[model samples]
Target: MGALHVLSGGAARGLIARLREDFHQHTGRTIEARFGAVGLMRDRLLAGEACDVLILTQALIEELVVAGRVLPDSARALGLVRTGVAVKTGAPVPCLETPGAFKDALLAARAIYFADPAKTRAGTHLMQVFQRLGLMPELAPKLRFFNNGSAALQALSEAQEAEAQGVLVCTHMTEILATPGLQCAGVLPKSFELATIYTAAITARSEQPQAARALIEMLAAPEAVADRRADGFE
Candidate 1:
């Protein structure tokens, strides 16, 4: 059999990668996955990308269902993933117990890494938070934007080796934990927290609907709750 095509948001990359070998073993088919910003993934699907499965924010999945692009009955939510903060491994964890502390930490950092605000949920929310705190002008020069959370965190991890001082990153908790050389400090302070429900569905145009559904079942299986939590899903 040929490969199963999947387009997923960066938030679910860890879980999917963890389960890839098992899925291939069970189904005798490899998975071809594209992980990126949710908005970019949605745009890919809309632009006629060949996809057997689609994993994205719950609201986006529902919108696709109504748009007749995905199977309504095949949708299942993986879990909630929160936007969080991260620091380089072995670096001092910043105090983020309150909104004020969070602001202070950002101001103190030499640089701040994050995803593209125009193409990701976490990035968009973080932008709003910075604007709300009136730090946009002050922090603008320190911002380093990437295409997705995983990339931002990866850059943060690499930056640590080159610089003696540590930097800060804002992305989904999953991305923080999944990336090596990075430590998950914690979720963003309550006032600026963003918890998104990520859901998966078989695409309406899937060539292997059964395989796609099986992959979704594996991802959302109740028995995998602990694994999901370890992977930063709530």
Candidate 2:
């Protein structure tokens, strides 16, 4: 069992702990994982960062493959995860059934927060949601972007202190809501829900190619899927 360095997207946030345990148990390897937004991780890899494996959206992984960063035929789909929405614990749940209702919820929100779109696909889609609902101009002034989950959670926590409402992020990081102080608001209705599929691949220059492949297989095993769903992905 050797050290396997991994560069991955934020979508895998909820299931990391389980994945680490399973991979270590299976191959006796310790995965050194670096999770960031897909775009940022892709930039770092393109800039020559060394990593044994890469786990990210299939679209991004295929882009890397096309650019000759990842080996052809190495990309393997893990599963799909849909973006989600939640409110901090104790907050009143809002009606998000229709597009108009969702827009109203946004306009009524005091301070809306989400990950930086340039760095995250979820945030990018959320931006599109705003545009589709024709609420961009009105909501733009109040929108706040975070670097990562911790930043978003911090904003959600602090909003209550100032007696202002905060719009929690909708992404695979939905597990963060179970962290004691946050509550479950509701996910976007089916009409607006976006599902993102994840894929894992060995980098073209990976030193631990075999180990990387083994880890990817372990992550896509049956048990891993259950763990993933428990973490708020589906």
Candidate 3:
């Protein structure tokens, strides 16, 4: 196998690391990945970056197919992701089990953070979530958009130190829960939850098309599900 280059978004971050390890161990092929925000990855691919595989949202996969950048038949559903909220570690996790409780938490927080929709799908849906919950007007002014949740987590820690209620990010950032300064507050209530389906496809111009296809298949296989689950991916 030649270089199997992958272009992927942050949603697949932790999972990609695990997959790459498994792929190399099994096939002895180097898996090179470029991770970015979803929109950034999309734009880069549109600009003709030579990517063998793309792991992104279903909509993005469809877009690439329509643009003739990926074969329509090569698209495969990988997993589903839902928005989760977390606060800095040790900060009191206010109850966000209901719509009203969520609103109260948002209002009480001094600064809230989520990624930008221009870069991530979570940020896109988070805007709609605020609207759907009817708290957009009140919360919009306080919103501080981030490029990634890792940075938001840093800020959250600072806020906690200041005794200010911290931020909420729209990501399946469960891995961050183990960090010393953070913990999951709670996922938004079910009624307001927005789930995004993640998918993978082989790029049309990939020189290693077969290897790309094989990689996708392996990642979606039953054995891979255990690693996916371990990484907080559903």
Give all candidate RMSDs, comma-separated.
1.1, 2.5, 2.8
> Using lDDT as the measure, which candidate wins?
1
Worst 10 residues of 2 by lDDT: 171-180
Better structure of 2 and 3 per lDDT: 3
In model 1, where is the ten-residue run with the lowest total lDDT?
157-166
The residue pairs found clashing in candidate 1 are none
lDDT of 2 by residue, 6-121 (tens): 88776665556667877788778898888778778888888888798898888889888988999877787777776656567677777777767777788888767778887676
Q: What TM-score goes with each of the models?
A: 0.97, 0.86, 0.85
lDDT of each: 0.91, 0.73, 0.75
Candidate 3, residues 1-234: lDDT per residue as tens digits?
567989987667677666677778777788888866777888888898889999888998998898898989989887876667877666678898888998898888777887776666677878887787788778878888887655555566566455545555556543354234667776778887867778899999988888888889987888788777665567
Task: Spell out the clash pairs found in candidate 3.
Answer: 89-181, 89-182
Error of 2 at 77 (Å): 1.3
- The best candidate in terms of TM-score: 1
Query: How do these models rank on lDDT, best leading?
Result: 1, 3, 2
